[model samples]
Target: MSATGHDYAITRTLDAPVEKVWAAWTDTESYGRWASAEEVVLDVRPGGAWSSVMVIPGGARIPLTGSYTEVVPNERLVMGMNVPGRDEPVLMALDLTPDGDRTKITLSQTFDRAEDRDQSEQGSNMLLDGLTRFLAAA
Candidate 1:
């Protein structure tokens, strides 16, 4: 937790293979299918860029942008993202573990400030829930 006061970690299991899950995260089209509420665009290689706009249930939209910091096929991904009005970027790490016929995905995000961390934890958990649902349907 940086100056602002928040810290969080979220994990979810998907009934899909690591490869399929990786594809959903790295491919723009598949990412949009699960991760995007309004829109999503991704350039998945290291140093590549990504962006998305999430529409809240009540009609507000929040935009997010980031660059890929690391990518390891179907195992891991690390990215740096910045929220609107925030001066510092947050670091996010995604770990995918193969579990027999399923995949366990863990997402960890660290913010420079505690306030942002708390806010992001809630939002990211919601997004992960959506991803779980989407993967189930897919």
Candidate 2:
């Protein structure tokens, strides 16, 4: 939870080393391998921009764009992302912790409206689950 009234968090564990998990996030090519099936164009530096088009199960493509707010090598990442046509962009933070052979990943997203926050919470959790599976296979 954030100081802002509209925020949500999701924590997940990956049965992989922290460095390997981090690479799945920081490496643009690796990120694309799991972030979406279509393609992911990521410039993963502070202030760098990133975008992805996810080919959903029904074959619909949903595009998302964001700018990196912070990029801490293997520890964390924060970004401000917006879905086109949406009113407010969300602030998303990904925190990683190493625990022996496993890694704990926490994802937090804050929105401006309560409704949006709720929706994002559910959606992000699904995405995180997908990420977890992706990393495990990598």
Candidate 3:
């Protein structure tokens, strides 16, 4: 959680070029290679929709869907996450920066409640780790 206490943020640098990183994000097949999802459908544009079916521990597939609020090619993406049972949508932003040959990415999600932010932090970090591994092997 941030000092303001409503956001969960994670930053990671992948040993890959900005173009490659951006391709991996914008391509559904490339995204599925990293994200812990059984299936993924993404349309990367403002007002476009994206969804994934996550493969959880119990073998149950959890559906996560979102709409693209902002998309700036290789630099930034802002998405509104639609979690089941939540009346309010959670907002997430990804900022990508070129760091030499590597790409640094900062991903942050905002929730209405601090408890929700705290609870999602670990999982967010774990997903970033997964992305690093996926990029390394790609």
lDDT of 2 at 30: 76
Which lDDT value does model 1 have at 51?
A: 90
Candidate 3 lDDT by residue in tens digits, 1-138? 455558866888889988888888789988887877867999999999999997766798888998999999889999888978988567788889999999999989877687888767776777788788888998
Q: What's the ranking of the predictions by lDDT, best on top?
A: 3, 1, 2
| Deviation from native of the Cα of residue 89 in model 2, angstroms | 3.6
Candidate 1 lDDT by residue in tens digits, 36-90: 5557878888989889887787888888798999999999999888756768667
Alpha-carbon local distance difference test for all models: 0.82, 0.80, 0.84
Q: What C-alpha lDDT does candidate 2 achieve relative to the native structure?
A: 0.80
Cα lDDT, model 3, residue 81: 84
Q: What is the lDDT of residue 43 in candidate 3?
A: 91
Which residue window of length 10 is worst by lDDT in model 3?
1-10
Per-residue lDDT of model 2, residues 1-138, tens digit only: 467677777887889988998888777777766666456877889989888887765788888788898999778999888777777556789999998999898988767678988977877777777778887676
lDDT for residue 43 in candidate 2, whole number 0-100? 85
Per candidate, the number of residue pairs that clash is 4, 0, 0
